[model samples]
Target: VAVSVSATASHPIPSTLWGQMFEDISSGDGGLYAELLQNRAFQQVTPNTTAALNAWHPVNGATLSVVADTVPVSSALPNSLQVVIPAGKTGPVGVGNEGYWGIKVTAGSTYTASFHYRFPTASAFKGSITVGLQTAIGHSLVSTPVPITAASTAWAQVNVTLRPTASASSTANNFTITLDGAAASGQTVHFALFSLFPPTFKNRPNGMRVDIATTLAEMGPSFFRLPGGNNLVSETVAQRWQWNATVGPLLSRPGRVGDWGYINTDGLGLMDYLNWCEDVGMEAIMAVWSGFALGGTSVAEASLGPYIQQAIDQINFVIGDPAKSSAAALRASLGHAAPFPLTYVEVGNEDFFASSTYTYRWHDFVTALQAEFPNIHFIATSNTFNPILSPNPLQYDVHVYQTPTWFAQNSFFYDGFERNATTYFEGEYAAISTNSSDIFGSPATGRLTFPTMQSSSGEAAFMTGLERNADIVFSASYAPLLNHVANSQWTPNLVSFDAGAVYPSTSYYVQKLFSLNRGDEYLPSTLPNPTGTLFWSVVRKTSTRQIIIKISNTVGTAAPVTFVLPFRTVASTGTAQVYLFPFTTVHDFDVWIPNRC
Candidate 1:
């Protein structure tokens, strides 16, 4: 609790509190006010999850599979594979709703298809498992069906060998591996941990595709957040993002249940995400499946080894070299014969829901990860846990979702936080909705419209809170970026784009504009809550020594404040670049003007 001090007759107001609010600062209240300026007294959250598949470098891809057995609600997994080998039926194992299936290859090229599987009983079918790769003529073939004869019950493995057709070596080929009649026989067929490759993606080898390659290049985004929301963990630890189950060939491994409301294609495995990030020049921030999943389930202290080891393997795959170890050998087969650089390893996402559950994991992962790689920084999902100062160093990841006015009103929310050396990460803070504004409207509307964009005044006030104390906030970013309006569980992404196009919302420009224009160092100034009808803030860039005044008029009127510069330090004088938000608006492409979906 903070010691309170109020406006009393003896309350000494310093003649000039620029150096320090010395007169009032000495009182505990001054220190309380100082808390606002500290970076953060706890952990820091960065952004969203980013993971992909690389036929070359298979890490978590081998342990997990994002399957799609139904209509994709979001970026769930690939579409379900259909049998019957109809002449033109085998298209893609279909991920992202993109019809590109597994890779097509050359004749005599030794290829392996490995996938994870869990059958209730091996005796149930006692038959060969069916798997296929679609052909160029739009026809599907069940060419690589491996026989599952001698195997244990429950969690099991299946592998199939296939030599590429005379067609091509690097072109796209559709590969689909499915448990033949397990499900039909009323047998529970579970698939997780699967993959397929020719010993070459990781440890630094080539693994990329022209189609996906094209999509990524166009986004031209500076960062890539993967693993996405909910997919990292399920309603329980049983549903955690298992990284080891996703590598190897497409057979042997069976894909698992996906939290994205469907089975995952596992198509976009761990290595895939990293490769995507690498291909797109995105710095990967690997977020471990924080203990808390959607519903109520997490890793108990006794059963965390698998979880902990998975973290180690994830780090190893990202930084390990190519050689003979099981993991390294797998990488060689995938396509990558090299290592991808890893800097940040986040422990969880939005664990505020399960502070008790996440606290243990967050604390454990931080210590273990830090001890293994001293150079790496750990980001925790909870803002209350700071591994750095708690006999250990940790950053509290912060996230806020609110209306622009709420943001404007809470601009000073961090003011009373602690002043420890511990830091913070503004991992995710964006206004969003999973719905497109089309509401039951026709298909002619554009994209969905949410109240995401607002005047710079609110941003300025918020950014000032950050800049005045940049020491705490190491970095920050908005979440649910790149939402395909047609299907999104989370809406109003930072930068929305499609196969052939990209659109930067007003919020995107706001981030680009402020973050780029800010000065080297920040000088502080104060704003009294005048009229209590506006949000105001100012920051003095150290290098340029220019003070940027940001004011947001929430009272439906231009509530202006007198401009004052201590040394007349205003850069170009009175008028400044002003940004505004409208009383009404929507974000839809011209063609879908009213569709809003």
Candidate 2:
């Protein structure tokens, strides 16, 4: 194949082309958030039963029960763990939390562990509580004694640092907070809001897991679409992701039952996401709750005024004057006096599910929000031109999930779109299955366990078309960014992880290559055949005087290709860099600079 690159540029490549979409599908509570313990606050959980004490277990035969306290530690957290020491107990007796699947203890790493405790009844017991990390079979890695000066009815907090001298052999470990049975046998103590955090991404309190955050940072993403996709919607309006409920001291934040069947601590809230954006050099693509639930429930038009006002307040909390809006004041109270930078505000997630009602919902929301914040661009999440949204939305978010072959065939998906004022955000797209008939089926029905070479190549080919038509396609991102390998609800995510390690799929590397090597200008080039197996796109970075050429060969066999630079002066001896990913091991790619092109 022969290719000729033009000297002149055609269009400017969008800076927001590559980004991340986050939701808590077992991804946040156990996967990304640095907090190790699961169900730490017992948020939204009923008292009693082993299920209420999801991760906690009795230690040294101590009786443990989840109890509802009249005078709870905080109103947001009504439930607490009550541990009763046996009358004749000899060793330490209390409770142990098997952190999300298991805790990963590293050598020389300092962990901050904290919990709120109070004696249910006034007692004279004055003894120290031992908090430490232990192996599954009862071997201690590190321990610290936090002395309880006086037993009081009112709750008191204890904070301690545990530095492990040696790492655990595996992730099958647990954290324990035990009391000396001899010091005060037959005493009952209540505990609430327990937290264990290893060093975070940037040492920010309640921050993200270092290893996972670092892996995402390496991709050099431009924006983060949060708090996440379908995770934004809920079975009911009350259970939806409320911006107000997610942005305060962890004690005040009333955690909710996440769309996924698990309790969300809300420890990683709105502020956490914005801070993450800043730490990783990315902007926020924030989404607001648009009075729609995943269970086919939409708030009536009359009731939408309050929800619309809620959206306005949500936006104000991000970029509003503190004196004018209470939400902004709350943001200022949380140490971010200056408002965070925000440009795109997605109206709702996947409104295509309820497009009939979206007509009025969109009208009511945009009519009010546009008046409040005219500078911000609102993205519509429904099928384009269907339902015919009033005021003619300036932007639309498109989503697609199909087989690898479908993605390759639909490379020119945006090429046919009318060149008008309205732009597009390919909010979510992925190669989920090999069988087109059962795209959303299980693994037995051709669903991908993880992104393979064929799927990644197909995605790459489609991305070339997105770059080719940069004028209409402003941004695009893969959906369901992360998944917990052990308890995943979705298949073939960009990144997969367990309690111990992270696994970046082939699709992840493809995204990284495109994002990290993005250029300022799209250089017109010789187009590939419409029905060909190979595709390419050319872009130029004006700052570095570098020309980037991306090529994708879908077939397994090697196919030779040559490029002829149309520049007046061609460098015959200068080094040319190449990043080669063969089909055999697509996950492992090689990069080297050759002596000549």
Candidate 3:
């Protein structure tokens, strides 16, 4: 492509255009979600050491029995595990928790372990309890003991600090708590709502995983679209992502069937996402549950009033007056007294498939949200019935998942969008390289396409078009920010990880480059006889007086290019920096590469 520059600024790009999307599918608490213990509340049934003991196992030849909570912590979670130690047979009797896959520990690092426990009747013996990080076979890595000298009928929480002298960076470890004493036959101690966490992102209680949060912050995203993809509304309306079901105490959160084919321990719920935004200094773009399920079922138009009202209540809960109602007060009780800074509340996700009912549902939600949040902006999904009635003018979500060829061909796709008709949010998009087809399902069968150099280059080219059309495009973000290699539900995620390590994909670098170098204004440049495969965009940062030029060579071979400056007089000693990505073939993707590599 031949390029020429002139002293003309065509359009000023919105600084908020480039951001990130975090869904809950592949990233549960065990993945990117910060809750350390998997099935901590024993809500998700798993085949393990005990019934309903998904990741927990009994230690020292003791049989741990799972039962309905005689002393319930909350109505949300009603199951608890009971450990029965006979009078003379056991060295130590308790449960070991397999956190996520395994609890990752660094040498000499401190972790917090806590759990709620109660004795059935008054225990005849005062058994001292020990809790720490350990291996599956009962090798303690970070052991600490806290004596339970007195038996209590009421449920009480015990806390302990553990510092491991050895490095279990393998992330293949567990949290074990054992009662090391003799007890009368059938004397039982019940355990409920156990948790073990490494150092958090901001050191807040019930906080986020530091590694995952740090990776996101480094991307310099301006906004975060939260509560996820198809997981926003599950296969059934009964299991949708509801803010009320996932707040306050961790034990109280009733886990649900994940839309992505597992269990969703809603440990990182509404407040967690909001607090993460505050921690990373990004704006919140909350996606509420629309009245439709992924199973091709939607609520009737007349029945949408309650869902709309719920949406309003959710907004109130986020930016509501705390003294106004009980729900608003509950938000304050969750530790965020001042209202969160929320501007965008998406009505439904991917309502385009709803066909005839989508328009009415969109209309119902827009009408209700506008009545309550007069100043707030609402984004319409791609399947909007009529964008003309939208509260936020022309704000419609545009999602694209395609191959490199498609991305290169559609460089001018958004240019033709009727300027005054509809504004756009490139909410979810990625280039699916044909080389690697690994996703979230069977290891033999691929899920989402893995990120490759070919794909990243294609995405970069597509982003150029997005930048060129910023006048109509309001904001854009990449989809499915995380994937756990062991149990992923989707692939080609921006970042991938296992129990031990987290790494960004080739596409992640492209996103980081564009986001970090975001400019203040778009400059008008021309490609005379532009080639089909080469894509480029030019912008100027008015504050720094620097012109940023981004170019993508999507073709297999390299092509020579030149830039002509718009300035009358150019600096002789000016510093110049160019970013060039190496060509990666489709077959080059390996999920286990280190993040920094």
Candidate 4:
């Protein structure tokens, strides 16, 4: 390939070009959020069955049942685990929770354990409650006794720390809270809002899992599209993600049923996301629940007034004056006196599913939101110019899922877009299948369980075009950023994890390479054949006085190529860094070539 090093810079590369998109498809509460105990709060749970107490079980012959307490621990949590110790029981008897899949116990690590408890009626039981981390076979790894002196009917919280002396051999472990059966015979106690957290990512309370968060941080992302993808919308308007219900103390934040059919603890709420953005040094691409749902329901235009107001309040909570808006006041009360930095507010997620009604919905929302916060950019999530949105959307979020070959062919997808004031955010894109006819079908139909080398290379080729047209494409991100290995609804995520280990896919490294080595200016170079298996992009870092060239080879066989620099002073001994992905292997290897001209 011949590089036009003498040519002027074509366009400046966007800083927001590479980032991540997050939603809870069993990825939160149990995946990224550090809390280990699953189904801890019993939010939106029906009492009195094994299914209701999904993760909790009786220990040492103690009878366990989930009960609806009249005098609940908090209004946000109405259900609690009712434990009855039989009169003849002698050893420790209470309840144990099998964490999301299993609990990982590490030696020399301290864990924070807490729970709320109350007696249904007055009792003379004065024994201390024991919290322990144990193996699946009931062998205690660590235990601590927290004495409870209050015998009143009112609820009380117990906070204790468990320092494990030894790590369990496997992730098949459990967190247990028990009482001495002899000391409190026939006593019935109700427990609510139990939490057990290992050392978090940054040691922030209710923070993210250390391993998973560190992996994402290594990518050097510029933005985070959060509170998730289709997980933002629901089957009905009433069930959509509510910003108000996701902020403040966990005791006050009533959890909801996520679009993925699991009870979201709301432990990782709006404030948490903003904090994550700040910690990671990234901007927030916040999405509001537009008046549409995934189940083909759109709120009437007349009814949109309230929903629009809700969106306004949501925005205010992020970047409003506490003296004026109540939502901002709430934000201040939660200790974020200063407004969170926000630039892009996505109106909805993938509204192309309900494009027929998005015309007015887009008009009503954008018209109101723009009036309130004119500085913020609002992104429309519908087909471009299809069903035509009013006020002419300044930005559009485009999503695509296709085969590897399809992605490579669509490298020039954005080259044909009109060069106007309008921009694009390729919000979600992935090579999910090998079969063109059944891209969204099952694994038997060639769907990928994890991203392969061919798929990653294909995505890299398309990203070159995105960089080539940087002036038109403002930002882009890989969707469904995380997935729980044992409990995943979506296949081929960027990162996958179990309770103990994290697995980053090939696509992850491709994103990392581009993001970490991003240059300030795009360099015009000799283009590859339009219908070839090898493609490349060239960019220049003005500050470092270095050039970055990215190449992707989709086939297994090596295709040799050479570069010719047109610069007046070419370096005869510069280094060449290559990230090679062989088609047959899932792993990537790095090759460093020194003294290369």
Q: lDDT winner among the candidates?
A: 2
Q: Write the per-residue lDDT of candidate 1 for residues 1-597, one digit (tens) a residue.
A: 111111112111111111000001011110111111111100111111122232211111122223343322112223221122112222222211112212435465545565545443455455555554444443543366566642454445566666655645333444544443322333334443344444332222324333223433443444444454456766666666666665553332334555654344443466666665675566666777755667877768777776777787777777766663556556656777777766666777777777766667766777677777788877667656532233244566677755455555666666666778666666666544322444223224433353244523454456546654565665556554444333444545554433223355666555544544454444344554532546544554455544455445544566545544445222332335445555222222211111111
lDDT of 2 by residue, 1-597 (tens): 988888899999989988888888878988889899988988887888778989888889999888988888888888888889989888888889999898999999999999999987886778899999999888999999998844579999999999999999999999999988888689888899999999999999999999899989999999999886888887888898989888888889879988888888888899898899999999999999888999889999999988998889999999999999999999999889898989999999999999999999999999999999989999999999888999789899899999988888877788789988889998899999999999999999999999888988889889998899888888889877888888888898999999999998889888888898898899988888757888889998899888888888876778887777776654444333333454432343333422233
Off by over 4 Å in 3: 44-51, 86-88, 181-186, 384-393, 433-449, 528-531, 573-597
Question: TM-score of every model?
Answer: 0.55, 0.97, 0.91, 0.97
Query: Once superposed on the true structure, which residue ranges of model 1 sit more than 4 Å away at CA?
Result: 1-224, 245-256, 279-282, 321-341, 383-393, 432-449, 452-460, 496-503, 528-556, 559-578, 581-597
* Tens digit per residue, CA lDDT, model 3, 473-572: 8788887788887876666789888777787888888898889888878887885223377888998888988777788888778787767775765544
Candidate 3, residue 482: Cα displacement in angstroms equals 0.5
What would the per-residue lDDT of candidate 4 be over residues 1-597, giving only the tens digit for each residue? 443443478899988988988888878889989999999988888888677789988889899888888988888888889999899888899899999999999999989999999888886768888899989899999999888743698999989999998989999999998899888778998899999999988888889899999999999999999887888997888789999899988888778889987888889999888888888889999999889989889998999998999999999999999999999999899888899999999999989888888988999999999999999999999988787888898899999899999888888889889998899999999999999999998899999999988898889889988888888998888867889998988888999999989999989888888898898888877777657888878888899977877878777888886666556655655555455654322334443432233
The list of candidate 4 runs beyond 4 A from truth reads 1-6, 582-597
Ten-residue segment with the worst summed lDDT in candidate 4?
584-593
**10 residues in a row with least lDDT, candidate 3:** 588-597
RMSD of each: 16.2, 2.1, 5.4, 2.1
Candidate 4: Cα lDDT at 150: 37
